[model samples]
Target: MLLCWRDVLLPEGEHVTEKVVRSSTMMRVVIVEDEGITRKWIKKKIEDLGMGFVVEGVFSNGSQALEYMNSHDTDVVFTDIQMPVMDGLELLEQIQAMEKQPYKVILSAYDEFCYARRAMKLGAQEFVLKPEITEESLRSILEEARKFQDQRNTLDQERLKSEGESWEASMRQLIRRAGDPDDIELIRQLEEQGIFLSFPDMILVDIFFDGVIRKKLALELLNLFLEQEQTKGTAFSCSEQEFVIFYAYEDHENSLKQVQKLRKVLKSHMGVEVYLGVSRRKQDCGWGKMYRQASMACENRRFFSIPGCQSYESMRITAEGNPSEFCFFQNIKQIGVFLGQRQYTEAQIAVERLLEAVGEAVYLYPAYVKTMCNEFLVLYLHEIWKYDLTEEEKGGTGAVELLFEQAASHFHLLKEDVLKAVSYMTQLLKRKSGINGCSAPVQEIIKYIEEHYAERISLAQISDSIYLSQSYASTLFKKETGKKFSSYLQEVRLEKSCEMLLDSRISIQEIAVRTGFFDAAHFSRVFKEWYGLSPAEYRKRIILQKGNRIIQ
Candidate 1:
């Protein structure tokens, strides 16, 4: 009625009992009897009881049953003492030597009480003299085995837990991490035939999860898998949702497949997607460097938009070249021209094309994407700001920083942000311009500029007076005059200055002040640049020419 477990008191005054059976599974039975009729009859009785025992193998001799049980799982072995080649007692001894020995039971039809005592001494759970064995007795034996297995499993788990803590403490001496168990959990040190990894020859794998999960359950499942696979490595929790695995140098191909299988196991158990980052063994690479590389690869999955895995060696990196130096200056220049001419659609297209080109690049390095987007943004801001003649834009930073807030590390997000910003700039330019045209609006801008030439005129002031936006006023004036608004205004100021100079009554300083040249020095500089003579020299020469013509 009870499992044959002889308990001994431990130092803590607790009794350590029997071992081996999963109570949840049906108890497996192997019957070994020399008489075929007795073996069949006993097997029929046990199976007919409908108890939690299933007769897996029925053998004519102990040797046959032992061979089967060695390779297969046999929770309970029912054998007769007398058989050919191998007898029941010898079989029980051999089963005891096996790693996972099943519960032993001796079966005999004869009244050999001595054989029963010998089988009990040899660690047999029950000795059944056949013809006396009944269904109720078999049920009691099955229930006892299940109960003992459950108790043993509990003790084993407790032992493993205590040992696991000691293992973690030992690992702490090796890894200098911030003292948070959720941040770092050191597992047992895995030992194998040949693995010290003294040289720089270990592949580090980092696992990343998107959100929080129960780390204890997750990591235990991973540990069980590693044990079953006979994988030798040091594993630890890097964070609540991230783990690290270090393997001695095997080829990356095998390591990759193994890691992929690990991923599958985790997914099957937890129903969560795991992103992986792997680091290869490189020359002179130390632990800190490798850890950083694996961490970088893991985090970069989001920016790079790769869902599964990324290895450091797989990334295309040109060590000598600078990613920030990747240029799209010509596109930037063309965009400026488009904005200046009120080509909003063209400007938008240019922006999209530029970003598309960046996206089309062979390798999307996170740093390069960031650098390229930043450069594109700055250059584009400066470019488009040229066309925005609003008084505020002229004085302020002109959306360089306002648009920069949208910058992101993700390629698609960055591209979307850049396109939106460019589109915004385009719309703003268009709104300021009011309408894109070559005729009436341009003539209005021209008249306004000509009339206001003498009194510190600017496109912003002129556009305000004429009820037009600064951007539209400037663009329209350029289209009408085949020159920029500033150049035309300067020419108008100089023409007025020249007319004043012909009178000779006004001093150069007075002429400069009246014509909005700011000073006589400015007047002279403009005159020399345009006509190769200073203002004073030009005035004297003109007077001399007039006098000679009058005398003639």
Candidate 2:
């Protein structure tokens, strides 16, 4: 019958030979079958055809074929219906899901034609029955697949031209703008461009670097690392200073290591401080939330975190219940007290602990934490305003507030900037004291008080330091400064003690000893008399204000 068919027709026309020449170039093929003999037979037959299709790979099952597909550019996949590990249907589904979908064909027995139909529905272009697998039948399927590949290649080129503009905008809207993923118009547009997201969970990794990063170098590093990990993640430069990668949560840990390594390599090679933030493995269309978590964690640069790598899981604060409101309120109040007493060091310490506590509260109670931080900022500003400050000092206060406002979601950075503002305020106070209208003797006395406030300062010692009798030095101090020697000394001592309470986490008893109080009990009594709270109570109040102020 074969000889008779060959004798029945003769090819004619230039188009016939041209077509044959065109189809002669090899098309890369991968064959998947559970039976080794059948797989080898199919591979050899495709190679022997000496036409367009050539078997580049032969796998005993679909899983192996899928692995090969990861690194190799496969033009067509010819797979059997049933196989171990991954079935032909599963392979076809994944291939269709790929950004560059390959042509698929099915080989099945007549009894399994129903499965072949399902495979066709899953994006298989053709099916060849096993018993009828002749050279002619095989060539017919391959020719059809080649045509399908040509059509797809043309469409892909057109898509690429528009995809950069359209899909990038769509991605920015979805991930950066927090646009609704369920928006009908958005879904329609993305579908038109064949951008589909099937996974319910996503892992977001944000990269941050100081100064401008070369985009070409940055993308080169990202692609190298992702390809090495064999990840299907997508990345884009969100801004000049930031780049973000979105990967499946199924490969979260592996992707995480890849991103971390990418961070280090960029730093070592580029000589830039590159930081990475990894979001918690989250479910649903959580790209925005994960982006914030990862980016902020990297930006925070907290003490407990390594500057180059921080994960949301590592930086997140966990509380079994809401932190005590009384604690947070007390801390804020203590910060006020420290500021009022001109103890900026202590104020800075109190603010640090306070921010850390609120940082933990942010996840469970965002609104509450925001209110407390704002209120605390107001308190800090009020305390600084009590003194006559220059315009520069006033501007410093405004800058601190602005910094806090900018770091609304990032408590660690807010804490650092606030501390710097308070320190600047303290310097202003010191300068103000220096230019006071007090006489030289009194100015010397004030200097002595500042330097020796933490020592066993006595009137005899104060006068002796300047070679004057106690009574004469006392009169000179009062006449010049309007405050008596003992009163001025007490004021200086108490102020210094308040500074110690705020600046250090030392025990109150130890603080009393260091700050020149012979008796811890007496120090607490005096501290209460001045600030209306014991030292220990003040410290606890500063650290525990997160829950209390929020509740109020």
Candidate 3:
């Protein structure tokens, strides 16, 4: 209708026309029509309605309108379909390809109405008959265009805001250096960039995520936790699967309970465990120490047996005295010997012991475990590569790289990788040799020696098990393994007795009986002859060398 309902209140000639009647769109318009009179009439009707909408340019055909509009910015286009040179439909289609297109309206007569459908498909926002072009009709279309523009503008602003926030979060992560948070210049830069803590005393929470998350989904989950009215803190992603949060230290107990609730919620919904480490409330800017403390707290979760948040005060460092990690190393070395002897069962048993050490040595740093696993693999590959392995057995550096990556992610993966690597070596050795370790006869002979090394064993006893003549069996064993039967038996007995000597529980006489020696005198003589020391002397010297007495 009209601008304001002041028609009844004001005199007849007095009007609130142009100022109040129009929409607030202020949308610029371009008109193209073959009929000059109709183009003038439409322009006049829009002007009569109000100045809130401006007709930027008017043309007799679509081609002229297209050229003028190309160099200018226009918000809307009104065109007639039956124009000369270029039709309204063509102009509408051309405008569709522009980077910033205007709202489109079509002016059509009854006969030309068939093309209106095609024009609308070409991106016309409204279509009106020439005879029906009224101020009300014009205002209706302008208001619709205005509403659409408002919505688009709002979305654009929101997108910009989201991007800027993401960029700021990324910058915060880069600015805060681990173990070096006190750099004056860096701190000043961070503060200048508005990355400082909001309170002097704040609790830092370090978070570690699993891996990837859908950005929108992650944001939705994150907003639920951060935007809670009871929680006053800021959280930002440090990297994929990792984030950090800072809470104004209000109450120590409250902070812990608050973040713990966040962790539980995230874990329950995200289907992944989340760790929240709370640092001892310190001066807010002293985040270097706080960051380290907070990180150390969460690291407690590295042991799968331990779950939930840990605070800075609860962090403990493993001491260096009497580490059972030594026992782990000793067991690791035994694996190679078992594999060489074709004792896959014993080799795997040794592997299980190493993994047990990994699980129990929670006091030890992860790097220590990672190093032990790496050394074990490196030593294994070095030992096996010395043999003329088949092409398949030489697994190359793929396993090496894989183990390294597994160590970085989680120590549990190291167990799996070690098994696979060892299995590959087992396959390699199996292929290089025969079924188990070597020829079937040789394998049986070695098995018999190790099983009964503490008993009175003879070559004839081994031959009977593998169904070979004693002389032939001895020769086959020597040929395949490069050690004579008697020599192999003596080596096994000496190795066993030496290990027992380290334990003071076994007596000299008992050692002889346990190792299948004929007597104490014979055992001492043979042990001295082979090892360059008598049993008692060897035990004393080893204890001295280790700087500790051998205990039961």
Query: Model 3: per-residue lDDT, tens digit, 487-541?
Result: 8789878876876787788899999999999999999999999989999999999
Question: What's the lDDT for candidate 1?
Answer: 0.64
The CA root-mean-square deviation of candidate 3, after full C-alpha superposition on the true structure, stands at 31.0
TM for candidate 2 is 0.39
* Model number with the top TM-score: 1
Q: How accurate is candidate 3 locally (lDDT)?
A: 0.65
- The pairs that clash in candidate 3 are 209-241
Candidate 1 residue spans exceeding 4 A from truth: 1-195, 317-347, 353-363, 391-409, 429-552
Worst 10 residues of 3 by lDDT: 1-10
**Cα-based lDDT at residue 425, candidate 3:** 59
Looking at model 1, which ten-residue stretch has the lowest summed lDDT? 3-12
Candidate 1, 392-503: lDDT as tens digits: 3343334345333222445675665566566555554553454233466665565555456667877787677778888877776776567898787787677666656776
